[model samples]
Target: MGVKNRIFKYYFPQKAVDLKQKRRGNCNGIVLMYHEVLEDSIDIPAWTIVKRSNFEWQMKYLRNNFDVVTMDEATKRVCGLSEGQRPFAVVTFDDGYKGNFNNVLPVMNKLSLPFVVYVATKAVSDSSIYWYDKIIGLLDKRDDLFISIEGDDIPIRKSHSNSKRWSLMQKALSKLKSMSASERDIEVKKILDENDARSFSSRIGMLSASDLGAMSKHQLVTIGNHTHGHELLDQISGLEIYNTINKANCLIESWTGIKPKHFAYPNGNYSENVLDALSAFGFSTLVTTKPGIWDGSRSLMEIPRLGIGRFETKSQFKARLAGFL
Candidate 1:
């Protein structure tokens, strides 16, 4: 622990941390959303990939400190049915990353933790790269990146600080988010061509259908459809949105032989139309990127989740679960 952290813990005891038990039987639950879980690597962006060791530590923390519940149980508790004899939390992974099988599964199995993995079927079936990963690949090819985003030349300085790298990556993501689907693809392609990024295929670090099949068969795992192409509902037409959801759900059902009853909005992007589509499709439980403690109002559908990303410190993780952040 850092000296500052030590001093803070010494002086300001997290009295509320102990109150978790008091809040258990009647309190709201939380759903944690994770993405890729991989070993120490610098080539990938930190936002999408949680280091394997850090993930293990976090799981250990959850195992020792929190009541790690499943989505079904969490939904019931959120709907005013009491918590399952302890303060409840549900673990979920977004996107179908291969490292999930390689790194996260073993840890979760060892810990005997139940979790839900949300898959955007296209990423798995087509063996295609998610756009965000492409961006990271483009950035990794060079230390000093000078990109032209919407006519502005944004110079990503060569810095040793991860914060600086993250800032630049966030800027790139923002620029990409502003573009239409076609435009985004064009821009990513341009970057790839310019960088001569040959090895940046979608299959580099993502799960295959067989991997998903194996995971689905795990007693502690549940598959949630995250839509094909991982499209943002708010950005696409209603028809496109419906087709995406239908296509993804159908593919997942075909793969797992069980229709998915749960869904998570890609990138937490949604709208009234998006909610309607989810409703039309009959997702028994829906989750979003919104950060909050789940209660009666968030059950079955439109549930909010907390993103346990690399930026979060140990204390911040606890604080977030405890509703202190």
Candidate 2:
């Protein structure tokens, strides 16, 4: 281990112990949200794109100290349906990144850890990559390019290196958020072509049907629907949003022989209509990217999660997981 990692591990145990003492007898569980577990850094710079070594360490720590459970178990505990004195944890990955199948699943299998994977169903069946991935890949290829959205000219700086790309992409994507769907698609296509980069589809490949099938068969994994297309629920009509979620659940059930009972909002943002739609579809629980501990009083449809990323050191990881910081 490096000096920093060694130091983190040395100091983390005391921090965990301190937190445990302060919140004595609090029956709370943590739902950790991870996107992609990668061996090498990708174009995106979010801390949640955790390195393989760090991810392994985090999992090892959890295995050694906590009783990691599935989303189903966490839901049951939150609903007062399970008898348990031991603390619980649930691991989930959003967006169905191919990396989840290629890299994360093997580690999980080796440890016999159970996890939940929420997928964007349309992306799974199609060759398209998620829009966010496409944006980052385009920016990575060209530093001289300037993206103009809504009369705002945002310069793409060469100095914004790989480590800073996620911040830059967030700013750029925010600008496009105001555009009509057709207009945004046109602009994104042009940007990709100008830089000789493949659109999102060619950048981060989605999980194939076979990959989903294999993952479903694993006793350690559960699949959840993340909408047919990752549409912002608040912006679309109620019926449209319902259809998106319903289609995804139907597709997953056909593929896996199990209808998913859990749902995760796209972008971790939702509307009242969205929640009602999930309830109408018979969803027992829903998860969001917001950070906090679950104490069973929060809305089951909007349970929060602390998103883990690349910037988190081992100490920070432990602190967050232990609810110390």
Candidate 3:
């Protein structure tokens, strides 16, 4: 094991014990969220990616020290059902990265652990890459681009680097949201071409239809809808949001031969209308990016999750998982 992995292994168990003690009777269960399981390098911001080694170490810790369960079982137990059940954890990944199938699933299989992956179905069919990836790639290559939003121009500076680009991208995307769909598409296309990101295909290595089908067959893996295009529901109309999520659910069902029961909001920011729309669609549970423990008494629509990413050390990982930080 590397230094980080060794350190994490040593501290993770103690952190879990401390968290368990802190929560006492109030501790329900933990819903762990992951994005990409990178082999050695994760190019994204530190807060958004976790290395494969760390992930494996974390899973091993769970296997040794906690009863890890599926999202459905954890939800049921939290809801006062499944009496006499022991404390457990649920593992979930968002944005169905191709890496999940390539890197995450193997580890999961080795550990015989159950996990849920929330996939953005639109990307499965699109040849182009996700816009966020394009943005990141652009920022990585060009440091001199000035992103203008509503007449305010922000130059990408080297000192702030990733943070500045992320903020600017958010502002730019918000501006795009205000435009009509066709207009937004035109604007995005222009941005991508200008950034020389047109050659980068987001779907180049993503999970194919067959891959999803095979994954769904595993009893340990459950698929969930993350929307058609992974749009931020709070920024879009209720009808658009509903259609996106519903479409993803349909596509996943067509591929997997099973209708997904769970939904995770893209970006995990939803308005009241989005929640109502989900309820209307007969969704039993939804996951959010907000961080907190799962209590049965909370709203089924606003489930919070602790995000794991590249910057997390083993100590930090344990601290976050144990609810210590």
TM-score (all chains, Cα) for each model: 0.90, 0.87, 0.82
**Higher-TM-score candidate of 1 and 2:** 1
In terms of TM-score, which candidate is stronger, 2 or 3? 2
Q: Taking the tens digit of each residue's C-alpha lDDT, what string does model 2 give over 1-325? A: 3564456644677556556734733256888899888776554455446777778888988776566898777777777888456667788998898888888898998888999999889887885776667766565354565666656766667776644565556677876665666888887776667656643333456788788999999999999989999887777888898789889988898888889888888878787777766678888778998898887788888898988877677776786776655
For residues 80-133, could you state the per-residue lDDT of candidate 1 as single tens digits?
665565667889999888888888889999999999999999978888768778
Runs in model 3 lying further than 4 Å from the true structure: 1-16, 19-22, 41-46, 83-86, 139-146, 151-187, 199-205
**In candidate 3, which residue pairs get closer than 3 Å at backbone N, Cα or C atoms, i.e. clash?**
49-309, 49-310, 129-202
What lDDT does the true structure give each of the candidates?
Answer: 0.77, 0.76, 0.74
> For each predicted model, how many residue pairs clash, with residues at least 3 apart or on different chains?
2, 7, 3
Give per-residue CA lDDT, model 3, range 144-203, as digits (tens).
Answer: 655554456656665665544566656666677677666767766777666566554332
Task: Report residue 54 deviation for candidate 1 (angstroms).
Answer: 0.6
lDDT of the structure predicted as candidate 3: 0.74
